[model samples]
Target chain A: MVRPAMSKEGQRPDPESDADHRAFANAAWSIPSYLLSGMAVYGGLGWLLDRWLGTSALLPIGVVVGLALALYLVYHRYGR
Target chain B: MSARQLLAAEGGNEFQAPGTEIFEWGPLWHGAPSWLTKPTLIVALSVIIVCGFFWAAFSKPKLVPRGVQNVGEVGYLFVRDQLARPLIGKDGDKWMPFLMSTFFFILVMNLMGVVPVMQLPAPSHIAFAIVPAAVVYVLMIFLSIKEQGLVGYFRNMMFPPGLPAWLYVILSPIELLSNIILRPFTHAVRLFANMFAGHLIIAFFATVAYWFLFEKLTPLGASLGLLGFVMTIIMTAFEIFVQALQAFIFTLLAASYIGGALHPDH
Candidate 1:
């Protein structure tokens, strides 16, 4: 494993890497929650729509759309 | 009496796989309140143990540290450098007392699962896990509001910059639910589910070993019993790793939340 260069005093010379690692971890952990919440919110709306319109299709559509939107959100926020 | 005769006397020869009943404990003693179960006792003991250990380690500071203080410094530095500093940025050290206590406390509670007498991890009970997660949740919200003004905090959380105005309509609710509702729920469940499942698995293997080796020790069953015994040992070792990891993750997430609150832009 390639270790990051350390200062003579033995501290990590690059604090940016530390921050980047932390951000990566935070983003990774948050992804699942974002996906689940997205599914719940949209799929739930779709369910209500299906009940009102007497069509059984919107729930799955809603779930898919929610999932896509969630992915897009993650990409927009973290993928950069 | 032979194992066969003992099995015959028991009337039910089938092995009973350990289940949720292993997780449930009736009080420590008769007439004790229903709430005063083993998990609760372990939680109380964890609190005392953590406090006592830290007190012993830090009560009298030595310029050249020795013994307990050396172990204490290692723990302190582990939380400070690995958890607090990396996640929380410059303000990390300020939160050491809270972060360190949370890490060690949860670590101890999780470790109780592998301990001989206290074989239940307190956080395996959802309630124990929830208390700490909820505390962090409430603290996060409070800190967010305090650091960022009330409206600013909600605005920043609900609507991230660089996104087009129209996208906020659909995306904002996801952010709201993820941040406000699901974060703590997942936090608690992650610890609870891991410990609960780990305990159940260990208990299952232990029961298998006991039943096969002693209760009904057929020649074929002896090898299976040995396997169970070996697995029980292996799982216990794995559980210790998992216990420590969960504690680290729990504290890391808590620090991240606090860091986010303190520095919303980050």
Candidate 2:
């Protein structure tokens, strides 16, 4: 039954509380950190695909997709 | 050429023209006397033009402000009251002029995207954003170090005394890292990325509109061309708001950074 604290003026309190700050920090970190990790994964996968397919053009596509996934994940959790 | 046709033919490349990258800095950089490209010239010109407008506007202040004077005053007062004073308080008394000038300077540059013929935002350049960001970064570090002695400042920033030991270990590094690194990076990147993305989007739609109207083969292409033009107009309005908002945000963040420096306790 923990409620997010509100300022006496009824504004949403600033993100300074240990819990609030932790939530924000974790959320922000997870987004960019995971996105970069996702990019690396896709980059590796794309390279493998290019080597197999002999097209050599899927690398950029994979990198972009990886980045997209990372951003999507970040966006999903940022507001909550 | 009419401005629109000229812009379209040149692909809105503001520098000398397409296919040439050489630039002449003249007295600005005496060493190089190269042929300047259109974008660079346009951007530099926009800066001069914007600065000139305010200079002229404020140079002769009337007892009752009129025309450009009124507009300039409004813009100036907006930054002074809403941004610099709120964050910096009494300390802002001296710095308000700097903050106000910087805010409007950036706003004018950002608004250039909406201006005809000069559709480029100067702050779209990393160097442009970096200049203001660097100012804030230096001010933040200076104030922090100055007000609290070097050790005291670092200790205050990294180790707030009230926090529990276990929490301190985890939170301190993050706080320190954010204050030291992420804040400035994000501060600059936020404006840079926003304007970059916005300009690119505008370029994409403009290209689509042009290609459809002039190069494509079908009636549908004509309709889509018009649609693109309409969207461009809509986006331009949004970009105006964004440009001003960004200018404000940059100033606010700068002031906040200064505030943090002045009063590290908060």
Candidate 3:
């Protein structure tokens, strides 16, 4: 990903070289927070559903679904 | 606990763990001047230390770079090379003052924990962390608006290029939530939690040693106290590493946020 991006851009003191490193750092800091916010938002929704429906099933399912969504979101934005 | 039992056997008081009360500082004066809390004092001290150090080091610039100038240059270069330049690129040098002050201010604040009498890191308090994080957050927003127009900024942020049209509704909120909301929250919390927990652990072990050795002494409790003392020694070293790392991470994230704001395309 980085190599292609660098070569694609014309050489200007290799600012592109730094992009990948910066991106890696940005990903490191944001990824966990993304996972957490995803879980909290969707898991809260699931918990509300469990309370309304009078069943304990949806919470775990909601949390799992949220995790998957978050993972997808992360990969789409940064990993690729 | 085991030490407390031994102390009890030796007709001494039980060991007690330190509590949150340790963090609850009392007002320093009659009126207390509203803003004169321990954390606030530490924050002011940190600013002074950072400014004073740089002033001493760089006030009289020598072409040859001797003594304090050498140290100042090293710190300046480290921030510019490692953090600012990599992310901000062409105009990176222009932002050096903000980035340098931020990095050093945070580093000094975090180091206050290890400084003898001043045992608390100002950033351990949420407000201290929030002040810097909020400043960065506001700067990011202001810069984003300045760099990209209001409509354009939101458009660029909420809708990245190349995503399918149908996926916009599903994905845009996540992007908004992660960038606008969670970014600052995590930024503040990361610094606060590390410093808070580090201070708590050190206080805990120090209290243990205090309880076993000075308050309730016994043959068996002495060994326990020795263990606690040793653990305190080890944890202090570990806390220093965490302190510096958290400072670096905080600054790195600040630079990252500024970079994102300045150039949304990336």
Task: Return the top candidate by lDDT.
Answer: 1
Q: Per-residue lDDT for B1-266 in model 3, tens only? A: 23344345556355666656667765556778766777778888998889899889888876677788778877877787778888776677688899999999999999999888788998888888999999999999999999998998989877877778987776676677878899999999999999999998998888788787888678988988888899999999999999999988888888998888887766
Clashing pairs in 1: none
- lDDT of each structure? 0.87, 0.65, 0.81
TM-score of chain B of each: 0.95, 0.82, 0.92
Off by over 4 Å in 2: A1-80, B1-43
Which residue pairs collide in model 3, if any? none
Give per-residue lDDT, candidate 1, residue A15: 72
- Compute the interface RMSD for candidate 1: 6.6
Give the top-scoring candidate (DockQ).
1
Q: For each of the candidates, what fraction of the native contacts does it recover? A: 0.41, 0.00, 0.39
**All models, RMSD in angstroms:** 4.6, 10.4, 6.1
TM-score of chain A, all candidates: 0.80, 0.68, 0.79
- Residues B1-266, candidate 1: write the lDDT tens digits: 22233345557879867667666677878899988888889998999999999899889877667888778877887787788878887668799999999999999999999999788899888999999999999999999999999999999899989988999998999999999999999999999999999998998888789889988899999999999999999999999999999999999999999988987874
Better of 1 and 2 by DockQ: 1
| lDDT score for residue B43 of model 3 | 86
